[model samples]
Target: MDLQQMRYVVAVAETRNFTRAAERCFVVQSSLSHRIAGLERELGVRLFARSSRRVDLTDAGAAFLVGARECLAAADRAVADAAAATGVVRGRLAVGVIVTTAAVDVPELLQRYRARHPDVHVVLRPGHSAELAAAIRNGDLDIAFLGLPESERPSGVESVVLDHDKHVLVVQAEHRLAGASQVALREITEETFVDFAHGSPGRAQSDEAFAAAGLVREVAYEAGAGELMTRLIARGLGVALLPSAFIRPLAADNPELALVPVVDGPRRIEWLAWSRFNPSPATRAMLDVLGVVRHA
Candidate 1:
C-alpha cells in the first residue's frame, strides 16, 4: 500500500531473512514484520511463509515482488528527476571497483570527479568483478568498474570498455624462459603455474588460452591478489599468467620477476557498467566525466 511497505517486501524477498532485511532497511525486526503483516492484511493475502530458520515468499508474494521492485525503482527515479530539475547534481553515488591494477588511474579519476562535483557524495566499494556486477544489477551500486570477459558480460546493464588488458607470462628472472621476449601457451604447458583463484576473469582467461592450445597446465598455487601471486613467483614457486598492467610495475621494481608477452592470450576488457534502468543525475554526471555515453 505504501512505498516503505513495498521496500520491506522486496528486501525480505531478496534476503530471505527478516532480521537481515530489517538490518538492510535500517529498521527493527519487529517493526518490519509488523508492517509487512499489516500489508498482508490490507491485501488479504499472505505474502510470506515465515519460520524461525528461513523466510520464504508465498506464490502471491513472488508475483507481487516484481511489481514492488518496479514501483520502488520508479519512485526513486521520480525523486532523482525532481532533484535534477532543480539543476543540482548533488546526491549519494555508490561506486564499486574491483581490486586490480587499473589502466585508467581510478584514484585520479575520483579526485577529478570530486573536484568537479563538490556537492556530490561518493562512496566507494571494493570487490571482485562478478560481485560488483551483481551489486550493480541488484541496484545496490550506481556504477562499477569490472574486468569482464567480452562474451560473458551480464545482461540488462549498459557498459563502456575502459581498457583492454592483456595477459603476460611472468616468471623468476632465473627461470629458463625469462630472457624470452614472447612465449606461447604451448611453451609453458608442462611448467608449474601460479594462477588467480578459480572463477576470476584472469584465471578464466588463462584457462581458456591453454584449452585453446590443447594443453593442460599444472597449477601449483592459486592467489587472489596479483601482488601475492607475484610474490609467489618471485620466490620461484611457479610461473604465472597475469595482467600486463599488474605485473609491469612490479617487474620494474623487482628485478627477480620477468614479464614476457603471451603471443596468444585472451585480452581481458575492463568495463564501466551501470544499470540500464533510469540512472540518477550523479550517475549521469560521472559517466560524462569519464567520457562514456550510454546507448539507448
Candidate 2:
C-alpha cells in the first residue's frame, strides 16, 4: 500500500529474518512486523511464510517484490535526475572491481571521487571480471573495472580499454625455475601450477597460452585472490602466472616468492564497463575522472 511497507517486505525477503531486516532498515522489529501485517491485510494476501528460524516469501510476495524493486529504482532515478538538473550529483554509485589488478590505483581513484562528490554513496564490490561484467549488464552495478585477456573483450555492455600488460611466472625461491632469468611456457609444462579458477577471465589467458602451444599444464590450485596465489607459490605448492605490474610490489613483501619472465606470456587487457541504458550521473563523473572521453 505504501513504499515504506514495500521496503519492509523487501528487506525481510532479502534477510529472511525479521530482526535482521529491522536492523538493516533502522526500525524496531515490532514496528516492521506491524507495518507488514497491515500491508498484508490491505492487499488481502499473506506476503511471507513465517517461522521461528527463518522467513520465506510466499508466491504473492515474490511477485510483489519484483514490482517493488522496479518502483524503488525508478523513484531513486527520478530523485537523482532532479538533483542532477540542479548541478548537484547526489545518488548511489555501485562499483564492481576485479581484485588485485594494477591497471589503475582504485583506492586513490575512489578517494578523488569521494572528495569531489561527497554527497554520493559509493559501494565497492570486488569480484572476478566475468561476474563484474554480468553485474553491469544486470544493472546491479553502476560501473565496473574489469581485466580480461587480450583475446577477449567484455560483451553486452559499453566499455573502454584502460591498460594492456603481460603475465609473469611466480615461483618459490628453491623451485627449479626460480634461478632462471626467463623461461618459456613449454619448459614449465612438467611443473605443477596455481591459477585462477577455470572459465574465469583471469584463467582464460593462461589457459589459452598453453592451449595455443599444444601443451597441457596441471593447475594444481585455484586461487581467488592474487595474495593467496603468491602465498601458495611461496609454500612451494605450485608455480603461478601473475600480472607483470603486480610482481614488483609483491616481491619484497613475499621474499620467498620469485618472478621469472615468461618468454611467451599471456597478455591482459583492462576495461572500464558502464551501463548502456541510463548510467547514473555519479557513474559519468567517475568515468570523467578516469579520463574516459566517451562511452564505447
Candidate 3:
C-alpha cells in the first residue's frame, strides 16, 4: 500500500526470516512483523507463513511478491528519471557501431567521450546496419550508426545522416583493368568481384550502383571483414567494391592493390540513430561529442 509497507514486505519476501529481514530493513523485528501484518490486513490475504525454524510465503504472498517487485522497480526508475532530467550525465550508455566505421573513427570518438565524461560507463557493441537498427528499436542500444535502407526507414527512430560515403573499386595492381586510367562500371562487369555478404548495407549499395549502370559483376568471393575481403582480392580471387576510405592506406603502401574510384556507383548514407521515446542525457552527450545533431 504505502512505500514503507512495500519495502517491509519485499524485505521479508527476500530474506524469508523475520529477524534477518528486519535487520536488512533497518527496523526492529517486531516493527517489521507489524508492518507485514498491516499489509496483509489491507490486502485481505494471508501473505506469509511463519514457524519456529523458518518463514515462507503463502500462496497469496507469492502472487503479491511479483507486484511488490514491480512497484519497487517503478519507484527506483522514477528516482533515476528525476536525476537524469537535471543534465547530470552519469549512467550506462550503450552504442552500436557498424564494423567498417568501428575500425576507423568510432574508437577515437569513444576514447574522447570517455576522457570527457569519466563518470559515464560506455558499452560499445559492433554490428552491421540491420542488427544495429534492430538494437535501437528494441531498446538494446542507446545509440547506433546505421545505414538506412532506401525508401524504407523504419518507423519510431530518431536518426541523422552523418555522411555519404562513396563506393570505390579495389583490385590487384596486376589486373587488366589496372592499366586503364579509369574503368567504367560496365567495363568491370565481367571481372570477378569480392563482395560483402548478403543483407549487408554495402552489398545493397553495390547492387544499386551496378543496377543503375546496367552491369552485373561476377562475385568470386564473399566475406565479412573488409581486411579479409581485401586479402582475398590480393590473392587474385576478385576485385571488391568498398568505401573509398578503407582502400586509401592499402593503396599507398601495397603496390599489389589499386584503389580506383568507381566512376559510377551509388552513395551509401551513414546515419546516427537513437530511439524516439528513450532519449537519455548520457546518450545526448555522447552524440554531441560525435558532432551529431538529433533529427526526428
TM-score of each: 0.74, 0.96, 0.69
**Candidate 3's residue-wise lDDT over 99-213, tens digit each?**
5662337778878988877777888887778878788887677888765435345456787776666767888888877766666788788888887777777688788778777
Q: What Cα-based lDDT does every candidate model obtain?
A: 0.85, 0.89, 0.77
| CA lDDT, candidate 3, residue 126 | 77
Sort by TM-score, top down from the best = 2, 1, 3
lDDT tens per residue, model 2, 46-82: 9999888779999999999999998888888889889
Residue 151's lDDT within candidate 3 is 36
Q: Pick the candidate with the highest TM-score.
A: 2
RMSD of each: 4.1, 1.4, 8.4
Enumerate clash totals for all models, in the order shown: 0, 0, 0
lDDT, model 2, position 26: 100
Better of 1 and 2 by TM-score: 2
Stretches > 4 Å off in candidate 1: 10-31, 50-56, 90-98, 118-142, 146-159, 179-182, 197-201, 211-215, 220-224, 250-256, 263-266, 275-279, 293-296
Q: In lDDT terms, how accurate is model 1?
A: 0.85
lDDT, model 1, position 130: 80
Enumerate residue pairs that collide in model 1: none
